[model samples]
Target: MDNQFPIPGPSVPGEAAPLPTPEEATPPPPSYQAPVSVKPPVVKPSPIKIILPLLAGILVVGLLVYGITKFIGSRLPSESVTTGQTITLTYYGLWEPSSVMKPVIDEFETQNPGIKISYQLQSPQDYQDRIKTALEGQNSPDVIRLHSTWLPLFAKNLFPAPANSVSATEVSTNFYPIVSKMLISGTQVYGVPITMDGLALFMNNSMFQQKSLLPPKTWEDVLSAAKTLKEVDPLTGKLTRAGIALGNTGNVDHWPDIVSLMLLQAGVKLTDIKGAEASATLSYYTDFVTKHRVWDDTLPPSTVAFANEKVAMIIAPLWRAPEIKSINPSLSWQTVAVPQLPDSDIVNWTSFWFEAVGKNSKHPQEAWKFVSFLASAKAQQILFDAATSDREFPQPPANKAVASLAQNNPVVSPFVTSFETAHTFYTASNTRDAKTALNSRLIKYLEDAVNAVSQNQDVVKALVTLNNGFAQVLSQYGLVAAPAAATTP
Candidate 1:
């Protein structure tokens, strides 16, 4: 229904209508122009839309973890092996620090999964005393670092490696000739060495130069040089500046070792205390103090006197160089192989240490395995090279092949030469049984003889006493049979 008034009004008054139209037009301006509805096209959601971000993030993180793990695997070769429960062994060491052992122990653990070595560093001074205590108890370490001189005393407490682990033939073939002499007794291989060491002559180069003397190569040369170099207090009749640190127990360090050198050089078999050669050797060692008066009890320990420039020379080991520097940094010294007997076959004493398994070890098999690794050429070489800092020389290489590697080193040259012809006489006991206990009372007996002679006691009487005491100790220990030596001197 439309209103009719609009058509009449449109013709009648343009002016009036215009006025009305203004309002009317404005009023009906957009007459039935109803808003047209426009709708946008619909978008369908993706299948994982809700979880896509979270899922993608997780996938990226997982890939990152996999990549990192693979990268780590590539870096550690030792971790390649699948492992079971770890076996931890305690190792006691007197000479080497934990820092030095760390590298090899870590590498070994890497190579053999589930094996851990707990190295306990010890002071060399208290090492024997402590180990002796540990051995008597149930809580002792699985492996121990034992000195060669201590072997005779501690051998009964150590576990002998089964022949298959370190056989006699292998010992003879792999190690220096001396190793078999000091360590292998009967069919048992008591220990394996990382490196070997022996007594060497530590000479004061300046003193030798001042006196215009050469390094002694024989007993007679040493005696002549000692006489020339010694300075005596005219009033006290005592040595003010000793020529050599020898001939006595109280004044000389390693007196037993010195006595051993004398006995071996003179061809006095330690097993034969009653022999004429034994008596002669005892007299000779004492004569330096009793007759020559080159060294006396008034001075400090041989090494101390040597360090203080109160003495001209000392017979010590490869380890003595650093000790000298530590005591007196300005001291100038040099080493030569220990002086041999005049015009006799060359011989030297091996005062070394080796790694061994404890007889009471809870993990004998695993402990032996670690010992085997220590004896390996690669390990020995690493040990030798690592030990070079501030030492007289790198630890003397024990492996026959390894020894050849360091043979040309000036400091090691003499030691290597000594290793070629070194001889050790462990007082052979009378025991025939393999596991019988044999004590090392020879060093004690030798010291007593040397001490007696230094006091101007009868050399013949001293020898007799030493022989009787040695026999009684041998009888007490039941060491009647000779130890099986793979190779002989």
Candidate 2:
């Protein structure tokens, strides 16, 4: 049976009556329920997508840093190193650049692409000191300019030419006989001469002609001229002019020149294959200035006398020729071989300038090659020409053949002739110390003797004292190997 109210359709067992009105209907509070179990969709990434972009960014940053660092480094100057392939050389000298030397150096460089050269110039007065300091400091130049007199000082430390560069026999044959001997000591040849110079009598020709005097040919003539020129003003009693400017205190390295020339003239061997001679030779030097007064204080210092024309003659080197011409172009002058004592044969002093190698040189082969080039006849001839024309020093070439090229020039003829008879000054094996002693003690003795003569001291006693002092110095250096044979002058 159907009830009229629709029997509360769909009524639950535990029913609560609900008003059907829309406004009155209230639903049970909403209840939360657990969600249904369903697996989430899986996603996979591609290797390229993950790694390529990251790697590209990293690479770009790395490249940028590298470029910046390289750019900064590029701004710095390059310092060269002579590794296994390259070579470097160092040279010292009185280098006056000329078109001649420039081409020679350029040619050498062009020939040896693997080599580079460094050059240094030193003044004549400081040459020895600079060399000694360099050697002791272990900072020596690969090649150095050496005066022949200073060779003995650097002998032991020198690097001889290698067998590959030149044989000893060839060296002797190639160079002048005297120069070859000079380069040798014991078993080793230590250096090669690049240039030569010698002492000569430089006379003011105009002055001689004015006085109606012939150029002095003998020591007596020189003495006579000195006396004639040694005039005192009647009122002032002061000297006006000195005939010959024999070397004095202010001249650079003048005493040795004076002593050596005199000794040679006197037939005194200052040194020999045996060693230094102590007595006869040095005593003669002492007597010449102190006792004879041939070279007296009456003459002014070299700089004053020569510059002022107060001296009519001077014993100077061929190198001085250019300077003289420059100083007084109007003053006519001529050079002659230095005069000899009446009883003695003429002998002049020889001096050489050379190139030497340093022990610590990075490129010894390159250094030797450069030196060889400099010593070559072609290079020497160029140097000779340049020295004559540009430098005014007219350095005589080391090569006799090259020197002969200058023979036609009248100004150079006398110097060339003088070179043939020149003798090297004696220098002890310990040359630096020996030269100092010579300039100081030996030179002072001569000076003192001159002063004594000026003060009217007995000439004989002064000479004896000088001789004794020289003997003591020789003994100190072991140079006086034996008792000197006594001789009466």
Candidate 3:
């Protein structure tokens, strides 16, 4: 669907909000980090080693005793907690201040004084390794902050949001559809998101007025607009001015996600490793560079190009909006729900974070209680208000009621309206060797295919290689691996 919201002059014209810095939101999660290179990024491994068997046995015994103590402690009432009865629960969070979370955490603690919560913050890169190691050793935090796309890696160590705390029916009824889809498996609901965010097109208003062009509504319109807005050298046939940032890895922001948008919109079954639809989608996405010449290797990083007015359009989640504004607040731009595949059902890509309870927690029930409260409408509004104070725009609320009230917000309305149709995918962990990382090979190679196709490599062959690499990863994890095929469906 074409975003119905008209492009307003300037939403927040003055100083931009800096709640989520670019360093925080680049690739995948609403806090996505752009894969900055053709080579799939590998984060520095954590120094913690698996405990030795002798020590591990002792640790396990100690943890058992502690669990029993905490269980007994939890039996105490909130108003009746004494020194020995307080059930302290550890929590891990990313990208927000303690102050932001403190307000809600305070309320949760106040209502349940016996279950006191202790919070810790970690950088994303460090947190990924730290939490994984902690969970492996049974020292996992009581509650975890999970990305919608990252739960696949952490699922084994996490407890499903228990029915007694938050039922699957309540979850399905309260949050956007994607929330349940991403977090639920079989009959279990895994995590709950405090906010929801999906990719949207960020267009340069000055460029639009100068050329008298409306924002691109479909892929065809995008290509045509790319050609018209772009400037090229007559003799060298090299681009001097790029139209839209697409098809390349180093320059284009969130190219992996952009490819996901194309693949899903084209009805490619992403789980089918060797499907023909996957290859065709790759070719179509790369064609923006190879065929259209709208974007070239010479362009700067996408968000920068768009901010400097060197490009006309870029696709990113609402989180990226603050980044562009931080770079150049004076540059004019407005967001619209990402353009859809022409003549197809409306679809958009969403990537955001969620909170879940850890399986190993001594106080699993208490952890679930806090998680359920975090997803409630009352808590979500408090969350939105807190984030907005630090950011130019708040993350769209995941609560249907909360989102409905925000439907009038130009930036959020389109997203909230489209939440029912939004989709998400798993993000492969960047750690070199986790036995169960789906994104490690598939998503990274998907990025590699984009880089390859943009350089005029054969799209089929590239996809075939991507399929082969992806198959190896899937098979390693005991999943069924199929050979690549020539047909799209």
Off by over 4 Å in 2: 1-84, 95-100, 123-126, 136-139, 174-177, 228-232, 247-253, 271-300, 426-489
The lDDT of model 3 is 0.71
Give lDDT tens digits, candidate 1, residues 376-483: 888877776667653546667788777766776766677777876776544321111123223246556766876776677787898878867666555444433433
Pairs of residues at least 3 apart in sequence or in different chains that clash in candidate 2: none
Model 3, 297: alpha-carbon shift in Å? Answer: 1.6
> Regarding TM-score, does 2 or 3 come out ahead?
3
Instruction: Report every candidate's CA lDDT.
Output: 0.70, 0.59, 0.71
TM-score of every model versus the real structure = 0.74, 0.68, 0.77
Winner on TM-score (1 vs 3): 3
Winning candidate number (TM-score): 3
lDDT of prediction 1 = 0.70
lDDT of 3 by residue, 72-125 (tens): 879978766645677898988877778778888888888887888888887766
Candidate 1: residue pairs that collide: 186-484, 429-479, 429-480, 430-479, 430-480, 430-481, 431-479, 431-480, 431-481
Sequence-dependent TM-score of model 1: 0.74
